[model samples]
Target: MDPVLDDHMHLDPVNGRGVEACEEFADHGGTHLLVLNKPSWHYGVEVEEGGDFQTAYDHTVDVVRESNEVLAGRAWPVLGVHPALISQLVDRGYAPEEARDLMRAGLDTAAEYVADGRALALKSGRPHYEVDEAVWEASNEVMRHAFALGADLGCAVQLHTEDGEDFTEVAEWAEAAGIRREHVVKHYSTGGVVGPTPSVLADREELVRAAERGIPFMMETDFIDDPDRPGAVLGPKTVPRRTRWLREEGYDGALERAHVETPRMVYGIDTRATLE
Candidate 1:
C-alpha cells in the first residue's frame, strides 16, 4: 500500500481525543500526520504578548512528542498563530495594529520552535469570513511574516484562509519573502483554485477532481478531534480509508502523487521512510 499521510489535523489532549485519535488513525492504516496546534485559547492561554504564545506552543510540542513516542514519528508538528486570533485579540481589547504585532511576534516564537527542530512547518492565514479592511490587511501582514519565516527556515507553511482564494496575492508575498510558491499551501482546500499547492480536503470527489485537473496537491483530513463535534470535518480514518478506495478504484498515479510525491515535495519528508 502507498504510505497514507494526512497533511493537516489537530490533537487536543486536554479537551479532545488526543493521542487516542492518532492510534485510531494508525489502526486505519494512516502512516503519517502533519499535526498542527490548536488555538491558544483552546489551551486556555490568554496571549497578552508573543511570549504568552510560548505556553501554547510548548503544549503543542509536548502533544506531538507523545504522538511520536507512540507511533515513532507518525506525527510532525506545525506551529503558528491561528489567523482568526486577530478578531479574538480585538474582542479582548487589543487594537488592530496591536493584534497584528502580537500575531507576528507569535509567528516569531513559532519560528523559534521550527529553528529548534521541534516543528516541521509553520501555520498562518487570514480570516475565512468577512472582516474590516484594517483587520484584513493586518492578517495578510501576519501571513506574509510566516512566509518569510518559512523561507528562512526552508520549511513549508500551511495557510488557513477563506474558501475560493486563488492565493495569487499570497504567492506574490511568498515570492517577495523568498519562499517557493509550492510551499505556501492552502489547508482544507477543495480544488486547484487554491494556489500552486493545496493540502486538499480528503473528499473523494475533490481529490479525483484535483487529480484529473493535474494540480500539485496533498491530502488532509482537517480532523478537529473535538469530541463535542465528533467527526466534524472528518474522522481520523478518512485519509487511509480514502487511500484504500483510490487503490481499489485503480487511481494508481493519483494515489502516489497525493500520498507520497506531494508530501515529499512540499514538506521534504519521505513518508515511505517513516514506515521503515
Candidate 2:
C-alpha cells in the first residue's frame, strides 16, 4: 500500500470547488497531488491584461501560497510562465527575445519558490501545434532557461507540449538546455515512455501501453477545475479509483511501477512512507 499519488490534478475556483475537490481527493486515498493553478485563477489578470514582469511573478507566488494553504501541505504548486502568456506580450510589441526574457524572469521567481520548499515542480515549455513557429521557438528558448533553473533548484520540470511529440526529441531538448532527462516530465503526454523519462497519462489503457513498451510513466486526471465542465478531464477521485482498478485487473505490477516506482524515481516525490 505505497502512498497513492496523483501525478496531476487542478483544484482551482474556475472548477469552482477548490477546497471541496481537495477534500474529495484526500478522502479517496490520494495522499499527494501535483496541483496546478491557472493564471486567471490566481490573479484577476490574465495574459490579455498585459501585467508586467513583477505582476506575473507575484501572481505565481500568490498561487503557490494559496494552493499550499488549500492542500494544507498535502500538495505543492507547479509554476511557470506559459507560452500563451508570452504570446500576449508578443502581441503587445515584445520582440521574441524580450518576451522570452520576461518569461525567464517569471521562472526565476518560480525557482525561488522551489528553493524555499513552497513548491516541488516547475511547469514550462512550448505550446500546442497551432502556435506560430516564432512564438514556439521563443517559448522553447524561455523554457531552456526554465529547465536549467529547475535543474539548479533540484525540481522536476513538467513540459506542456504537443500531445504526441517524440520523447527522444524532448529529452534531447532538455539535455541541450542542461536539464537532465530524468528531471523533465511531460504533461498530457501519451503513455509511450521511450526512455528513462516519465510522462503523465490519462487512463488505464495508456498506462498499459507504456508498460507494454517497457516504458516508465505516471498517471494523471488532468482534472480541469471547470465547474461548467465538471470532470472535463477526469474527476479528482479518478487516480485512486484507477489505481485500484488496475490492481484488480491483474496489472498490479504496472500500477506499482506507475503509482510508486516511477513517481519516486523520476519525479522524486518523497517515498519514505510505505504502504503496509
* Model 1: worst 10 consecutive residues (lDDT sum): 65-74
Models 1 onward score TM values of 0.96, 0.85
Candidate 1: tens digits of C-alpha lDDT, residues 170-257:
8878988999888888998886655548888989998888888776788899999788899869999998888888788888888888
Model 1 pairs in collision: none
Candidate 1 residues lying further than 4 Å off, grouped into runs, are: none
Best by lDDT: 1
For 237-267, candidate 2 gives per-residue lDDT tens digits of: 8878877877787877776777668778766
Kindly report which residue pairs in candidate 2 clash with one another. 1-275, 13-16, 15-225, 15-226
Query: What's the count of clashing pairs in each model shown?
Result: 0, 4
Best by TM-score: 1
